[model samples]
Target chain A: MNPTAIRLSPLDNVAVCCRPIEAGERILVEERELVIDVAVPIGHKVAFVDLKKGDKVRKYGMPIGSVTVDAPAGSWVHLHNMKSDYLPAHMRDAAGDQA
Target chain B: MMSGWLRSDGRKGIRNAIVVVYLVECAHHVARRIVDAAADPRVQLIGFPGCYPNDYALGMMKALTTHPNVGGVVLLSLGCESFNREALAANAQQNDRPVETVVIQEAGGTRKAIEAGIAAVARVRNLVDEQAVRVPLNISELVIGTICGGSDGTSGITGNPAVGRAFDTLIDAGAICIFEETGEMIGCEGHMAERAATPQIAEALVASVHKAERYYRAMGYGSFSPGNAEGGLTSQEEKSAGAYAKSGSRPIDGVILPAERAPGPGLYLLDVVPPGDPKFGFPNIVDNAEIGELIACGAHINLFVTGRGSVVGSAISPVVKICANPETFRRMEGDMDIDAGRILEGRATLDEVGKEIVALIEAVAQGQATRSEELGHQEFVLTYKSSAPSGPSCMPNAA
Candidate 1:
């Protein structure tokens, strides 16, 4: 069977879950097999190596953002622990304009 | 090759629809009612909602009215709006596109204006129909644009790459291909610059992305969204990288502003982000506005990639929706023309899907209605934005 997670590039620190991965499920990353410690939903990111706070998170071979807290290998990397490192993201205001 | 309608300027059109444009917000209802009353698929509705005049809006309206797909035009004005209705009608007439104007205030009221509009549409439609001439059109004469909406993690991996492959094929066939949303491409400027055809174009590409970065930053925003993160995209640059894949691997031929036509035929990048600061609120308030800009630049059709599925079609041009998520395709099969998400399931390869899309484009151009077109999704929108004319460096090989 193909791996449940897909790694986009050799430089990427995280892999995208092609299918929902359960806690303790085994997956392969660059010929190295690792066990997940958390349930990573489909299309979410799973860190392949432990990363500290403010470390750049690489995906598709480039830095997508930075983590806000120290995250261990096999853990979920998402909005809860990472944020955009470029310009501040524009959220919908009370008027609900995309601006 | 397909038989098509030949326009006065030696350009071939895939469709011969009559466009009805409302010059201002006040006249929108009357124009829409007129289109509804005509009940003809050859008639479409498009308009601008501003009461104030903007050069970009005026130029875009002119470009759309005379687009190869349009056989004629019917302009609706509210009588006191700042938009110059007479100039628009004159331009359409100058291009030999039969045009008629109806002013609501001058025509008495809304009811009377609608009555006049319906009658005028019938006359215009008959004129264009009588003028139609069947001519042979090849893929080289086609200008195709692409945009990704409701993007998710699956979009970059499946839909975008499939589109990239299609773009490469189309470019090899000598067709003009364009991809926009510079704001979404902020983080990938360095990567895109290397693929530019000329050193000047490479500089322009980098500068344009930097301009977008500055503009979005001033608005205290990046183009990233909560849904994007939910769908496995973590940062603005990540989404940019995914969006950048639609350009394929071809060297970018030129950089054109929103309303400017392509300089000859090759792959081009459209700078949709307005120059200067965030004066017009957002660069593109939504995806449809970007589609509007694409149509203005003379695209006969648009290939829209959506993981979350957008059901929008343009007023003057048809939109072919490609679904990126396999599960989403299963749920919304009726809305999409191509199911690119199958690549993820091992059901198809990327090249297979790319060929399917190219064949579908020829079929669609030869009068096969897209699912969105059949569903009557004529969503048209244009807002205020500023732009300086493209420099000589932006367009290579000028007279």
Candidate 2:
């Protein structure tokens, strides 16, 4: 992650990828270096730490959504593993297509 | 500083526009013909198609008719619509803007009404051109609004923040700025409330987002669209993170419902969703409805940020399109005013693009046509929605 991923706020546990990150790329978060487990496109979020099911995903230091399944650090965090706590995000309907 | 046309209400406008409104869908063709036949760039068309009277639509039409930018308004009625055309015409007249109405049934037929409307438009155009005072305009007099349509992930990173930067600059210099779409700003209410200038305003801001959330939830859908996901947005909250960037880092001044003018200068948030139960089908059916609300709130010019790209301009005010995606901007060269995608490519920095946008606004205020305007993209739409009238607390300064 060196600086390719934008850390919006220090309190956030996730960072938005400023540039696309390939699988196995190194990502730096909170002084810890982690390898991205999968390719994440620009603007998509990447986990800064190991996320448990029901953990709140933070970006810009605010809770964007909640994780639905446990995910390791640096994994692409999107519709597959996360769901909005406010309303059902439309991407859930076409989850299979996202892959 | 640029010159603006002075209105009777002491507010100056960047353009002296003559708006032609059709009371119902039946008179749409005649209204369009009148505007087209006038063959003048200053004459623009806007209307409500639903014959069933909606208080929201009437208020919006009244606001537009007397909007600072509008020099006059022509109401095209088909004689048998539920719309109250008299109230709109009276509002225009009360505001001292030339007002006229042509009822198709009363004018004998479509052809005669068109002739009457054309004549009316010409008379108003001449009267406005002759009477409008050219006054020195400064940044303080500006009321700028920003909105995003066809947003992708890149929008939050590029165009949105660029507009944010520009909004910050304008607010720093004492100009009024507004950002809207509460439905899109969900999940950030806590953070946004922190920026409110007053504690009461902060509470109001949070309530507004909650209102949008409740309304959309009842509709069985979030504001997230299929196009949004296709363009790299995964969820409503994710899109909101980007959409909220357009507000920059200014203190929230106050809130205003649709068709209510901003009380004074500084940064204001427009709550587009209705207050009570979801009476209206949707808050806003499309982007243009939101734009219409912005215009009704007296925005002199709108900065429309688009990642997927939208080619739309308002009737009363010029819309400056800022393209967020460099790839999309490349594909549609002439439709956008600012290429914010340059931020992504590193060809331009955020500050550079922001300054460019501010400069373009000044240039446009001095009477330069935006790309959408030059290309004839006058897309206007007004849908039904109701909100309780704003209280004195909503406009802190005016109160």
Candidate 3:
């Protein structure tokens, strides 16, 4: 019930992992009970539901990135399973803002 | 608990400055020497590093030299560059502020120029200190700018959003908030346009971003910096969304540039892409260029959101770093102003950090020099660039 951990928007498929969710720390999100599947680091995201590798990573009610690999419900969503949906052809470059 | 320094234009100033400026790269050393000799926090060094004629640069220089926050100005000129020294002086003169100039070639050399500059700064500092007095001010009259540099994946989710919260708060209080770097706005036109308060203004907002995308596309380069990828950013649009978050949720009022001021309060976007051609080399080759635009827009202070980390500040405006990444923040805490990552760490709430920013804004406007200011980070840079006025579709509110 702490205010620090918040769901930015209802449509977002993930919640910012504000605090380190322990192996058994139960949390309530949008009336849905999500049991911790793995340790989600702070500033990272936790899966709102079961997701496949190609499913989109939703935040702010929009697809911010997409799952690079498969992720499970209550799993930590990050680089391994998500990549930017905008510029996909190239790696990070200073002037490569047009993805 | 908030107070400000009143300027002649009726706007309040957050700083009372005696800016010693170099008209060209050739005179930069002299300007630096003078500022060093003066050795006062209020006496700051800032200058253009370019020698060629640049309209944007000139307009920006003039705007900054006479910013409400500045009380006096001293020009260090090499005397041969087409920097329009007289015009800059004349503009400062119109404000009835103390302005003196020393031409290194005519002042015998850099040594004499520095000496003259030092004395001028000393005199101006005395005058500025005497002239400055706290005036009751409100949030509505404030002009704030938001910029991003050294960004990573977290920038958008944390630092940028945190600034967004603060911006929303400031705008609610009637402050004029500005966010810039059109080049970064690529792939974000739809979102930005949707946020425009009016349909007409929304179209204009879309057009400005479109223009920027076209300009960069012509250059055969994308706005996504490679450093961005290493920092966890994967796409240009993702980078843009993060960059866009700095605008807050306020409806787009209009678009302005480095040398312009917002006509009124609300959120204004600054189009930083050069109007046309790659002739200007790089629209804004570095972060300073964006800061330059914000200063020219009459921004008294800046909210710089960073994910990787940035240390550069400005000559006319004080930049407050909003650290978005915890690792980045840990490595560069000294350079940072706020740690937005605290939200991620469960140590603070978005609104809590937002309030902290609001409180810091008050403190800075009340004459607290930012960390950048304390470190003597008075960086100024300008280059040649051309911009066709935005099509009528842009800035529909600016009749």
lDDT of 1 by residue, B1-399 (tens): 687789988888899989999999999999999999989877999999999899999999999999999999999999999999889998999899999999999999999999999999999999998999989999999999999998888888889999999999999999999999999898899988999898888888999999999988887667776567667777788789889999999999888888789978899999988887788888888889999899889899999999877788888788999998887898999999999988877688899999999999999999999999899988988999987888787876642
TM-score of chain B of each: 0.98, 0.98, 0.95
lDDT for each of the candidates?
0.88, 0.87, 0.78
Error of 3 at B184 (Å): 2.6
DockQ of the candidate models in sequence = 0.60, 0.39, 0.24
lDDT of 2 by residue, B227-252 (tens): 67767676789889889999999899
- Deviation in angstroms for B368 in model 1? 0.9
Tens-place lDDT digits, model 2, residues A4-80: 67667898887777667899999775577878988887666788889999999887677778899998888888778
Complex DockQ, candidate 1:
0.60
Global fold similarity of model 1 (TM-score): 0.96
Error of 3 at B75 (Å): 1.0
Docking class of 3: acceptable
lDDT: worst 10-residue window of model 1 chain A = A90-99
Ranking by lDDT: 1, 2, 3
Kindly list the per-residue Cα lDDT of model 1 for residues A1-99, writing each as its tens digit. Answer: 555788889898888877778999888877768788788776678888898899999988988889998888888888777878776543336126742
Q: How would you encode candidate 3's per-residue C-alpha lDDT over B177-295 as one tens digit per residue?
A: 99988877876788887888778778777877877777776776656665676665655666787788888887888877668778788999988877655677768878887887888
lDDT minimum window of 10 residues, candidate 2 chain B: B390-399
